[model samples]
Target: MEWAEFTEQSHKGRASWTAIQPENKRTATDNALALKEFFQRFPEYQNRKFYITGSFTSESYGGVYVPTLTNLVIKMIQNGTLPNVKLVGMAVGNGELSADQQTNSAVDLLYYRGMLGMQQFDSLKSCCVDNYDQPLTYCNFSQFVVVDDFGNLSPNNNTNDPKAIQCGKLITSFAMDSVWATANDVYNSYQDCYNFTSLSSGGLKGEAGRRTWKAIMGSKRLRASVQQSQDLQSMFSTGSNPFVDQGALYNQGSTDAMGGFACYMDSATQVYLNLPQVRKALHIPDSLPPWVDCNIPVNSQYYHQQNHDMTPVFQSIIDSGYHLNMLIYNGDVDMACNFLGDEWFMENLAGSVYKFNLLSDRFAWNYTRGSFLPQLGGYVKSWSNYNTTSIDLLTVKGAGHFVPTDRPGPALQMIYNFMHTGNYNNSVPFSLDPQPLLPQFAAPPKPSFTRKQADRVWSLPGVTYELNFKQYSGYLNGVPGNYLHYW
Candidate 1:
């Protein structure tokens, strides 16, 4: 906890909670060992079990490139350079494992998911007991708020009651704009459900930045949760509504009622990746420019780059004694990487690098049994070093910011009981059989103008084709101060 008591008790300042990546020519440990030498030059990826992920922890490029390419593929299987790289465990859902312990657990996880309600959680708990004498859950506020199964209060529930001196002047104006802004009210109240209106300039990831990047390339709950039930009943035969909104990630206005359910999953994933038998069953390769789900110039180059504090490369990969199992999950309506800031970053890296006697206390994992529905599935805390390396720190119940797209069956039974039998104890009853294959990608190139290089013109006066571009291949003029798109 000592980075000056985690920056004056989670005021989260000295920056660096993970960014600085913009170079892109390559290097995130050389694109994770060039994707483990393209899956060890494929042979149906032999003994496979490789799972590695990182979705948003701020202007992502898989925030810290998926945990520095899963610690350089566990330092190439502890030096033998990928000795059969089984690498069974590493999960980061909700990224940023520590930007000041997730900006001190995103202002008490938006006031325990009431959305800073209980009168702004008692005015940020009496402005942290009158300026740091302590309490507002010791300024980090920790976790709890569960209420879902349709009873409501789950759209990332930024706790609510609204008043503690206007929630201490809206948490000191979002901690003066970045202790990551106390987890930015869990992404403006649960995945941009709404409430951002300041717009004279840009902040909150530049409000409506490029129409929320063309409404997340037409998001439909991220393209019908990856299709297939008769191709999602013949491409949604009147069922598509992953929360009807398409202002793309926020700034919906005009009395914002609906617009930004990842913009209809980025416009039905550009017609399910330009169909044609799903691009010949995912081979793609026609040319390359259409599917775009939030790429405003690589999220404006990780939102104007430069950031770091990777908590000493996460305490040099758990004090590098290396054995690694680390899970560190979260979703309790994630305000992007919130699980009380990775449970105070594994209780401040188990009392600052193991000396604090291999910690372990917080528990409760619950499930109740329902292969596809029941869940409490949250709360856990573990840490060990004596037995080489361990760390759990979990939470998933109800979820948000994509914990397998919000609780995909308790996030696949808590990742198949923490990767086949390491059992993270959710009081048993998880049951797994036939549920894992959703990571397929391959189909993306083919746009440089087709259907007769389509064109048509009209300047305004109730515009016709909104200016030009008849078919597909780009060049959409739309004149007037010119808004081009030359394919």
Candidate 2:
């Protein structure tokens, strides 16, 4: 689709789509049809079994929410945004793409946004429909990550920079084209240079774009699924009574039913008598009870159970085919669609791909405490019985809410390796493994504060009580243990 047409469809009633993400939005037939046509026009990805990936496929529909650390867009190398990347033209020096064709080629991302699991579509619907509500302003900027290209199906030991490798340029280039509200003259035209604060102000990416444009275009919507979860969980207090009211209302207010004031739970009516004014007394508002005002980000356990609603449709796609495989990549640091959340998702997924460790040069450790035990932030697998369907939850080291941003190299290699081996590669650690051992520090001038373990065999005399003479060798408040070893 041309950038102009892309802008038209993005705001036209279906006011919620971001052009470069893989979020699968439930869309009207016309838009879906248009998407299919757009992909058909692209020579590189027209056919040959296409599989889409990104945040859009998994994001919950809602209003203009902020971009949690999980918004993969910032991590993904969007086209010309990276060094030596070929946008509309080509890799500047590599001459891989022509400048004239780069813009059009990158614009193809607008198509990818429409093509992949249709996350952008779902996000669009949520923005324009599902989450429509008057908020701080009639104007709003909704930020939703539709698709993520973080290498779930990364290729093998192929160590080539993913950007320079096959399919890399194409995907990133499209991502670049998808940005209009922030950059690009094409999107700027529709933006009409509508000026407003960046979406980051509300602690969000403003996926909808400039406030001026959003207000003029229409009210942005949030996905109903996530909104529902947030709504329900928000009502419960961690306090004594998790719920204020349910089914029916009962009152034990002044009446201590059994001498001691016992909150009544009507098994039949499912109402609570302990609540101040039971449902029996109030005019039950049409919406959630007035007492529900809590914040439950998707990353919280409150919203943890909601992901089951987001099982990727692509899972079935892999099962439907024979010689194919699919992977679901997640960055652990993403507070929203975090690594742990993905882990929980995989645990629930019924599959047969073998589960194992990611052996990389990065930090690796096994914790003895089960609850506090971290996966050391690496990959764990969920595979299919026939070796086709698989989901590998790859954890990033020291990564917070966003993996690509902090550990882009590992994320990139993960995808590269996935594409290389249709199965998990236990050999590749998260990084170079520090195999040479960081130069050893010439014996550290001491033994790393001492590995001597306290129980050492002393061959010398019993006067063993050595003195530091006031200052000396080993580690102590100021004194060295070695000084104590002196006679």
Candidate 3:
């Protein structure tokens, strides 16, 4: 679709793209027709099988559109409208399938990660009924702190009650405030936040730095209010903002470094995509607006014409008897579309919806990097419908919202295994037999390098050392400056 046709100027003077609207049923039919046209143009490849993969919001779209497209193509083939096209399966990573599950699981994740106080967690669980479905009059999970568009923080409705104010501060400190403040890089908690100033100032440099910046820019999105704060009315109403809301993302702090693997203030991707040469290569017209990670107008103006819960669509595909396989994977550390909620969704599908027999108990999957020993990559659970269909729910340990960027080796191995073996086990070659030990050598003399040189060496990228003894080292507060000392 052309960019102009995909997006339109809204009455609010914003560009709204219809392509990514969650409830846009026309997208499926369009996609199916596009596929039909593709086969018509290239009849020789009609017998080829295809598999689909999507991440984040695209994953949600895939959940609905992929199956719908498949069904449409099957009908077309039966009716002699189009040639036969085989869809083998699909894979979704950190997908936002159910708003209820995603929203509730985020709170649970906060509590589990020690980001919420015990009392506050208990209160939320009791009052909100373990979810965000309760009305504000009954339970105000986010009522503690109310932030405005100008980054001003105040008590909810400017309440002067002492308890309310304290609760607000507590929630702000624990839930909202982090390394990136309001734009708290919810995708990955442990990653360092970056900005254009930092990047341009040579704080991050060299090819390694450029790669890191590219990865961050490519993954980040303008995810303001898109991750949370959906009202019941909007969720059910058509032509309403079911995805994006006027809640936390805007009110908190700067959304400059919003989406992606880490929080970043600027998008290198936007800069690159807008370049004249790049635009010419991609055939982007000059009349289109400059590129952005996420279309804010589209997010706010999208219609929820389709079912939010996509389990039925998935179940329909499985029952279609197309020898289908589905892989629903999540990064364990991702709070947006959390692993727990996705796990629950898959478990419910297997146990109740499909009545599929459990093929494997949840077990640790390992991955290796460089010469490092095999480490726990994540956990996996599998379900099978005899031999016709299979579903696997897997988690990538220590990964954030973007699993491929977070754990590239593991992610590649996982997808490779899924395509071939239909499971995560034995993704890479492994051997139980022990190899011959190397001959012992004399220990090297203590280094004569200066402390600065040692620091430089230690800070070098991709450097790892095997130490004989455990060493504890950390930064310490000082009068004028912090001290980095080892004990």
Top lDDT model = 3
What digit string (tens of lDDT, one per residue) describes model 1 on residues 1-487?
A: 0010001111111122335444322345555556667657864664566656544222122445555666677776788766665665566665555554554466665555554566545545544444544445645322222212111111123556443335434443342233222323332234432322222113324334323422232122222222211111111111233343333433432111223333234446667887778876777676856554444454433433233335655666666666667677767665545666666666767766565454557766765454545445787776666566676777766566556644455676676677666565543454443354455753333234222323322234565555444432334438766656643
Candidate order (lDDT)? 3, 1, 2
Expressed as tens digits, the lDDT of each residue in 378-410 for candidate 3 is 999888988778888898887777787666668
Give candidate 1 regions above 4 Å deviation. 1-65, 68-72, 75-77, 83-115, 118-120, 123-265, 274-318, 321-334, 338-347, 354-487
Number of clashing pairs per prediction, in order? 41, 77, 3
User: Which residue runs of candidate 3 sit more than 4 Å off their true CA positions?
Assistant: 1-23, 55-63, 70-82, 128-183, 195-266, 280-289, 302-305, 369-372, 428-487
Of candidates 3 and 1, the better by lDDT: 3
Residue 263 miss distance in model 1 (angstroms): 3.8
Scored by lDDT, model 1 comes in at 0.48
Query: What range of 10 consecutive residues in model 2 has the weakest lDDT sum?
Result: 89-98
**Model 3 lDDT, residue 285, Cα:** 90
The CA lDDT at 212 in model 1 is 42
Q: Could you tell me how far off, in angstroms, the CA of residue 336 lies in candidate 2 after the best superposition?
A: 1.9
